[model samples]
Target: MTGLIMNERDIVVPGEKIASGMDYLPGNGTFREGEDIYSSQLGLVGVNGRFVKVIPLTGKYTPREGDIVVGKVVDVGFGMWNVDIGSAYSAILNMRETSEFIDRGADLSHYYDFNDVVIAQVTKVVRYKDVNLTMKGQGLRKVKGGKIIDVTPSKVPRIIGKQGSMIKMIKEGTGCNIVVGQNGKVWIKGERIEDEVKATEVILKIEQESHTQGLTDTIKNILEGKGK
Candidate 1:
């Protein structure tokens, strides 16, 4: 038989027992030993029927294939660009994936230079955690005239909310264009500088208080000018 020993949303530590029995299966941030399940990281417990998982509260961002992320150009090289995507390793964006072709002796810096920000996707992850990035898909491009911010990767889902409802609220409320990256980077742009600042504050708030209940309501109140 299997049973959950911890309540959903409760914080758990590594090696702490979360469930027991073969009937239960471990999900992310959890592992199984015999009929027992234990936490593999510090995170909140989540139980769905026979499946139990943990949502991490703090950790470095891990790159995943097909994940869209915001990145900063760290260096422009001969035929490749190095991007800082908030990971343990920098990601590589090659000229072939960036465009069809360019002159052999062209200045790559003209295309992407140091300190420029962009929205990209992870196309491959090789051994030793080397990441490859691409920006050819829809809505992926260089980000100009916007402020970029950071948030914990684990809190990104909550910042997005159910079907992007939360982010939609912030955009509609402040008239800001926001792009959230899976690597914990956010880019915000608005007509008024104040709107952009407010939106950033709101996102940071959500990042900090994602585990708290009624967070949507709180954010709604903040956006409506009804709360601080």
Candidate 2:
């Protein structure tokens, strides 16, 4: 019965019907018809037992409250910084949220300059989609001593894997500390230069083959080969 339909991780297009009957339920990126499930966007199919879902292959990150994101400072102004988070609108990080003491006349560049990468959390998102970011939290600050990279925002989950098992493997294997932002910015830091490069390769590979099955083992082998 299962083999009659599209396999897991198969790329699907919009309005393409993939499954039928009451045995399967539609999940993300899919919608239910009379007795069939159809893909609502370009994505990869996911069949975990009886639950059917679609993993989006391409999309931008939409801001949401409490979303931790890595952003680049693109512009600086009066008491605020504009961040590019790969979205239509740039997120705003105000100095008030950055420190307890902020003088109105003080130069903001002393804290964050143009092109500085920052890991921040979306404290508030207005109806107009203006994202307010804050760094006053544990492990949220300017990125230093690490390599920053970008990936498709939609692929972040696959990079994270089930219960964060995938990323954990990459970290343990490469001996790198990794921070993943839901906005698709990743910061990797390793004790050794070679380890950081290895970790970066693993991350990019995972992003490329995120829909493939058995990816965990595949990534492990790549990391091991680099270690040797």
Candidate 3:
């Protein structure tokens, strides 16, 4: 008979037995050996039908093609801007990927000077290092007049919640324009600075307690209580 050795959302480390029997299959961050499934890394256990997986609790962001990310312009070079996307490998945004056309040697820094934060999409990633970014799409551009915060990349989904319900609630409660990046950067802008700070606290709370059950209801209560 198949049996779960750990509860769903349980914190597990590598080599921890998660399930027993052939009825279970291993998914991401898990491995199967001798008819048993084991956690392959430190993460929260998630079970769906017969498949068991572990969602990482902490990790660096790995840029993937088609991911929307927030980046800081670190340097301006010939026809390209080097961006730090909170990853080991910096990304390149060529002038062609920008929203406007450029003339040769036309002062690239005029477009994206150092330390400017922008929301862009990853267009290509070669060998996990050569990442290319684009800023020609909707909602992609330099973000100004907002506070940017970083969280553990693994908790991004929990911060967003299902169908963006969590983020939507936060935005409504604080009356802030918040943008969450796949690279774990969150930008919050509000008419009042207090609102921005509150939104930041809520997002950090979600990141901290993401593995807990009843998280949605809990977060909703938090927002409502704070609004009063």
TM-score of each: 0.87, 0.78, 0.84
Per-residue C-alpha lDDT of model 1 across residues 1-228, encoded as one tens digit per residue: 458889999999999999998878999899999889999999999998888999888887988899999999999988899999998889999887774467888898998889999899999998628899987899889888889999999889998989999999999989999999998999999999899989999999999898789999999989887423
Error of 3 at 91 (Å): 1.1
- Compared with the true structure, all predictions reach lDDT values of 0.90, 0.87, 0.92
Give the C-alpha lDDT of model 3: 0.92
Put the candidates in lDDT order, highest first.
3, 1, 2
RMSD of each: 2.7, 4.3, 3.0
Better of 1 and 2 by TM-score: 1
lDDT of 2 by residue, 12-129 (tens): 9999888888888888788888888889989889998877888877887877899899989999999899999887799999988894577888988888999998999999988727
lDDT of 2 at 33: 86
Clashing pairs in 3: none
Model 1: lDDT to the true structure: 0.90
**Error of model 3, residue 34, in angstroms:** 11
Off by over 4 Å in 2: 1-11, 15-40, 44-55
Residues forming the 10-long window of minimal summed lDDT in candidate 1: 96-105
Q: For candidate 3, lDDT tens digit of each residue in 1-228?
A: 579999998999999999999888899899989988999989899999988999887777888899999999999999999999998899999999999999987999999999999999999999879999999899999988889999998889888989999999999989999999999999899999999999999999998898789998988898899888
